[model samples]
Target: MKPKKNPELEIGRNSSLYFAIGLNLMLFLSWQALEYKTYDKDFVAIDILNVDEELEEDIPIVNINTPPPPPPPPPVVVETITIVEDVEDVEETIIESTEANQNDAVEERIVDVSDVDVEEVDEDVEVPFAAIEDVPVFPGCEGEPRNKMKDCFQKKIQEHVVKNFRYPELATEMGIQGRVSVIFVIDSKGFTTKVRSRGPDKILEKEAERIISLLPKMTPGKQRGRSVKVSYAVPIFFKLQTS
Candidate 1:
């Protein structure tokens, strides 16, 4: 006799799989139910704005009275000119032309050199220290050779500056320090003049000029065997010593 149920076609063969799927579906549904949120219908409010029910505002109109423009300016009056007849006889003066024509002969005068007055104009000739044939001689540098006079002059100048250097009290207090360039001219009379200086500050410049002005009168420099003004420049240092 044939079996009522075949073992290969048993319904319980996939029972574990079906149980797992059903368990997973139940877990998902439980999680969704736990996360679900509900809002009260009474807590919600809906605002309905009726634009047609708005009140119309009427703005009051103000009338401004402006003053009328001023009256036009009065017309200008002109005086009438009258013609007057000359009762006395009038004589017209004629201007004679002084222009020379081809027929006119010009007088020639001879100029003699002896008759001509020659005014000698003493010109102020300035020669640079370097370009001068003879450099201004400092008092102590007279013993130096002519070839080495320039070096001696410079040495004497340095010595003089070192001896006469006095730091300005104001400049020192203000911490002003720099090199001041002093320019002065040794005139033909051997006197120092036109002493000017430029530096970082006016005080320094003034100090430098004072120092230059204190220089002793030197022997005037010569060019072409003639004494001339010699322009010389020196730099004075205003430095603060660091302790």
Candidate 2:
């Protein structure tokens, strides 16, 4: 037998629709509750000022007593000038010129070469090692040939440097090592002078200079058959050996 109640009006059929509407309404209420903000009741109270009431301030007036202006300056007195007449006669001075005129005779004197004194100035000439005609002779290298004198000189210099080279204690301890270029001048007297050195440190330079100063006296280099000063440069290397 068919049921008499209509299927469209059945309560169970509309239950899903009502449940969905109630779920949406519940979600909206939950969102509103989450979004609601609550302020603290312990807030600072601000006082409202009434614009109808006026504020009166009492300002005292001060009286300034200034000194009177200084009296006007006194009038300047003018002195009367008197005129005097000269009774004595004055003489005028005349300056005479000592300049020679065209009519004056000039005497001509002859200058003799014997009457004049000539001074001979000895100039100090410096010749470079490479450009010198004769290289300075070391004490032991005096027997070297003229053409081999340069090589002999260089060999002697190297031997001297090796014999006298001493590394500075300070430099060694501080690990300062470099090549020191020593520039020295061999004067006409064969003595080494004006020794200067440049290096990474002053200690190395001082050591190089000390070594150069110990060089033995040599025969002065010559240019044009005349003994002159010779300028030579040598580089002393400072190296630290690692074991």
Candidate 3:
């Protein structure tokens, strides 16, 4: 009365299950064959970046075996031709040369002296005697009882400057340094007359003249025991120490 079991149907199911498992295995092996591929070992060409288009440079070669050329020769010199003088002129020339030789012979003969006496002259030579005796004269002071005329002149000038001499203020400012040579004639009374600057600056000359003018009468210079007026030169120096 219950539902009957299907034995035939169960057998059929078992067979179908085994057949499905085998089919699944075959499908897996087919997929592995298609998915996992291997390549052949033949030579293959590969694509790469191209970069071989640049031009190459060439170098120049130099030769160092060549030698330099020789220099040019020097210039030639010509012989000079001289003209001969007339024979008559040459004869005259010989005669003149002979005459010159005779004159030279005479001079040589005169110079050669075996018989002549040679004496060494003494060192003493006679000096020229002047009628006038040289004496230092002082002017008006001729009879002033002064024996030292030169000394008096020097002293008088020195005294006059020492007492009243003042250096030129302008010259001192300008820095003038030199000796002024002044020539003056002393009268019989020792007064300076005709004062002139013989050398150097005009300013110095004027100052020297002023100085000589201020001097008193001096003893006159004497020549041969006579009181004679003398030309005296005095050198006045004006040197400024601080310019």
lDDT of candidate 3 over 102-143, digit per residue (tens):
445443445457787989653322111122133343343344
Q: Is candidate 2 or candidate 3 better by lDDT?
A: 2
TM-score of each: 0.59, 0.58, 0.37
True-structure lDDT of candidate 3: 0.63
TM-score attained by model 3: 0.37
| Residue runs of model 2 more than 4 Å from their true location after superposition | 1-102, 143-145, 223-227
What tens-digit string does per-residue lDDT give for candidate 2 at 1-243?
977987567678789999999999999999999999998878968899878867789988876786788999999999999898998999999999999999999999999999999996767999889999998899898787999999989998999999998888898899999999999999988999999999999999999999999998889998888889999999999999988
lDDT of 3 at 168: 87
Q: lDDT of each model, Cα atoms only?
A: 0.92, 0.92, 0.63
Q: All candidates: CA RMSD in angstroms?
A: 13.2, 13.3, 17.4
Evaluated at residue 102, the lDDT of candidate 3 is 40
Task: Supply candidate 1's per-residue lDDT for 124.
Answer: 89
Instruction: In model 3, state the lDDT of residue 24.
Output: 100
